[model samples]
Target: MGAKAYFAVAAAAISLSIVAATPAIAAPRAAENYVAMGDSYDSGVGTRTYDSSSGDCRRSPVAYAPLWAKANSPASFTFIACSGARTPDVQKQADQLTSSVSLISLSVGGNDVGFASVLTSCQLGSDQSCFDKVAEAVNQARTTLPAKLDATYSKIKSKAPSAKVVVFNYPRLFDLGTCGLGGLSKAKRERLNQAADTLSGIISGRVSAAGFRFADLRDRFNGHGICSSAEWLNGLSWPINESYHPNTNGHSQGYLAAFKAAIG
Candidate 1:
């Protein structure tokens, strides 16, 4: 899909999409005062993807970054999140961060397109071949994600070193117990999580390698994967139409985990 409107939730996965709304008021995010940065996941993409106006940023309450901030005691915060943002968008859009800030988090890397492409490619492949191909894609993310994270985190640090930086990782598609789509084998989902795991490892490792604290949310969300009864993520209907994006629940889980890690 083309770049979505600033405040609009374009066609995305139902499980993962949060429609855009008017730019909501920036709520308090930390005790020591902090700021938030990232893509639609941070902006609550899946919780609800509707616009307060025709052209406002979707500010769903279920979005993880805002929820995480509100969960803690009130502190000053600045938000620079828009849907469909990738690495370059961040470098250009979110540069005014302050040095004395207390915390920061970035939930990204799903837009690299390899995962979706793999999903599509493996849909018609034999079971063994599907598994093998998915494995390869995840492996690629393992190697490439850290460097991208490193550059972004360093830029964030240059603007806000004192802030506690946490790289939020992606969740598994479906529960380990469940895999296979109506048109595809569930084994691919396992491969999807394996990739997510690899990316998570890269993110956590790179963050720690740079002397920053890393919060690994992968294991913490074991059974709550995409197709779980309580479904925390939405692989097919994410971004409401795009599929594979996190939903409101996904953002909530991320926010809860990130906040608890930052303070508790």
Candidate 2:
């Protein structure tokens, strides 16, 4: 071949050699299988946007679980969490978890301890009544709630043995020092805050024992409780039942970040 032809052939051979040496770019990894199991907070009760197909569960598309799922694009996403779900309800949700599940996230024990009722009673009733309610809730949180949480956690582990479970704690609904907006008295708010702390401590400890990651939201919502200037939790709503649950902003800014960190 002539000089120019030989040069062209050599250049083509060099290009092919370089291409062979260069590693091919990898395709994005497939999303993990995620199942969300818990109560109203996990179900997104306070948010206006909801999955009506879920019926009474009120699983909202804007909920932290779905928000995480959407952002991460999980291969599979099952939102089995329900409103008013106690530990028993969580156990039932565990039935949906299978071996293929790779990720799990939830917030439980709130309803198990009658958190809503305590808040409502504290708001509408007298100080003594509020104190009594707080005492009862604290008792349940200490006594029955732990066992219930453990049982639920065990069931979860059994269902998805290899899954990375991320358990989220409920945020305190009161700013204590500032929480007098509704009928809840300052003293009652302080007691309720204590109740929340008691419940969260138990749940967080149990989460560790269960070999699951615990996402703490107590401090995350410090200045964003029901009493804050910019409350993340809804105080008293017209529907009434949705009171004190995290609002949409709470789910996005507060719970979503905690979940992503735990899962990652």
Please name the candidate that would achieve the greatest TM-score relative to the true structure.
2
Judge candidate 1 against the unseen true structure and give its global Cα lDDT, from 0 to 1.
Answer: 0.64
lDDT of 1 by residue, 1-264 (tens): 345653244334432444344356543343556566677666556665644541344656556666665666546766666666676767655477776677776666665535666666666577787777777776666767667767877787787777777666666666755544553446666666677777767767777877776666666666777667676766555333435556666666655665566544
Model 1 lowest lDDT segment of ten: 6-15
If scored against the real structure, what TM-score would every candidate get? 0.73, 0.87
| Model 1 error, position 128 (Å) | 6.3
Candidate 2 per-residue C-alpha lDDT over 99-134 given as tens digits, one digit per residue, 9 for 90 to 100: 999888988888878887788788789999999999
Which one is best on lDDT? 2
Give the range of the ten consecutive residues with the poorest summed lDDT in model 2: 175-184
lDDT of each: 0.64, 0.86
Model 1 CA deviation exceeding 4 Å by range: 1-31, 50-59, 120-136, 178-184, 238-242
